[model samples]
Every structure is written in structure tokens, then in C-alpha cells.
Target: MRPTLTLIAASTLLLATACTTTPLPPQTIGQCNAEPASWAIGRAPDQNLIDDVLRDTGSRDVRVLEPGMAATMDYRADRVNIDVNDRGAITGIRCG
Candidate 1:
């Protein structure tokens, strides 16, 4: 009986893990910009600038997983994640 309970617990854990949602899709600079009106957006900045945005924003959906360009100079959107290069320039922005 104990062995059966353990097996059931293990199976339950596995099923719970599988129910987790997938992470957000990595987007390109052009693709992110094309989406009109996001939840947030940062000003013209490189990828490193995103670190602060991610930390302060408190949203896992915001990730600069790839290199990309800032579509807007105002850094306005529903929710924006900026990716930049070594020179402190924005490569792309994603909105959610």
C-alpha cells in the first residue's frame, strides 16, 4: 500500500509539472515593433538596459532573449522589453 501511494504521489507531481505554462516566445526587433500598443516600453537603450526593466517590472513575460531595435523613441507601450547591444542602443522591443 505504501509503494502504491508513493507511485501516485510521483505521478501527481509529474502531472502538475506538465500543467505549467510555456514561456513567452522570443521575438525579433521587427516583429515586436509591428505589434501596436504594448503594456510597456523602454527608451532607446542597449540590451543591458533591459536588466533594470525586467527587475523593476516584475513580469516574467518581459525577456530580451534575443538581439533586436526600438520602434518607439518615447518607450511607451502596454508592456515592453528592450534588447540592445554593447553600445547602449536598442535592438528591439516586445510588448504584451
Candidate 2:
């Protein structure tokens, strides 16, 4: 009985853990006509040099999706595609 109870408890924990936030549905591709010469975002000046320019920009409320690229902040209904080049500098910005 004790072993059975332990097994049941473990099962319950597993069930609870399995319940997670569902993923968002797919969205249309965002527009990226040209690069943003110099747009004021919420990050510091040296942010681009340190890490992923998008991560530093702090542009949340994202509604669109950059399928291949990864996102770090909370996803929202207004995404801003922060495009960067090979050197980790912001090359473009598009809010959707």
C-alpha cells in the first residue's frame, strides 16, 4: 500500500508538471524593407557590442514571429523584428 501510494503521488506530480503554457499559432512574415539607420530603443549604447542586439533593445509586446531566430522576452501581440548582421550590430527594426 505504501509503495502504491508513492507511485500514485509520483504520477500526480508528473501530470501536474506536464501541464504547461501552450505555444502560439503561426503568423505571417513581417516586413523588413531596409535597415534602421539609428533608432532609439530601451537598451544601453554598448548593448549591441556585448550581445545579441535584439536582446538588448528591450522591445517587448511582440506580435510577429522570426521563425528561425529565438526570442528572450515575454511574447506579446506587437512584436518588433530587430534584425542584426553577422557582427552583432542592429541592422534593422520593424514593429508589427
Candidate 3:
């Protein structure tokens, strides 16, 4: 009888665990759409361009990455990353 109760408790616990829902990761929520802002590539990076990129890409924030600049590798779905060259021209745009 004791072994039967233990088996029932273990099965109940497993069932509860199986029914639990895991939250979506940050990268999966509010993802930035960079396609609209692809037109900004090859243009100069400026405050206006940054603002436009943010609006167009539906990103909550913007990060300008220049050559040799150190940046964190963290992935943010609501951010737009603008990569520029030494000539100060925008080279690439992406969402992480």
C-alpha cells in the first residue's frame, strides 16, 4: 500500500511538470523587423537616420557599431544594430 501511494505521488508530480508552460525567451518576443530599414545601408549614420531606423525596423533601441568598436554580444530582439565602416558610411543593419 505504501509503494502504491509513492507511485501515485510520483506520477502526479510528473503530470504537473508536464502541464507547466515555459515562458518564451527575450529574443522570441517583440522581435525587430530589419527589412524595412535595409534601405538605410550605405547611408551615413546620424541621429535622424538612427531614429528612422528605429521607427522603420520596429525596434525599441538602436546600437551603432563602428569598426574596431567593442560591443556586448548579448542578443536583444527589440534592438537594431547598425554597422558602419571607417568612412562613416552605414554598411549593414540587423536585429539580434
Instruction: Using lDDT, give the best candidate's number.
Output: 3
Please provide TM-scores, in order, for all candidate models, with all chains considered together.
0.30, 0.27, 0.69
Predictions in order: lDDT: 0.51, 0.47, 0.92
Candidate 2, position 1, lDDT: 92
Residue 62, model 3, lDDT = 90
In model 3, where do residues sit more than 4 Å from their true spots? Answer: 1-30
Candidate 1 whole-model C-alpha lDDT, 0 to 1:
0.51
The candidate, 1 or 3, that scores higher on TM-score is 3
Whole-structure CA lDDT of model 3: 0.92
The backbone clash count of each candidate, in order, is: 16, 6, 0
Off by over 4 Å in 1: 31-96
Candidate 3, residues 1-96: lDDT per residue as tens digits? 999999999999999999999997655445699999999999999899999999999888899999999999999888999999999999999997
Order of the predicted models by TM-score, top scorer first: 3, 1, 2
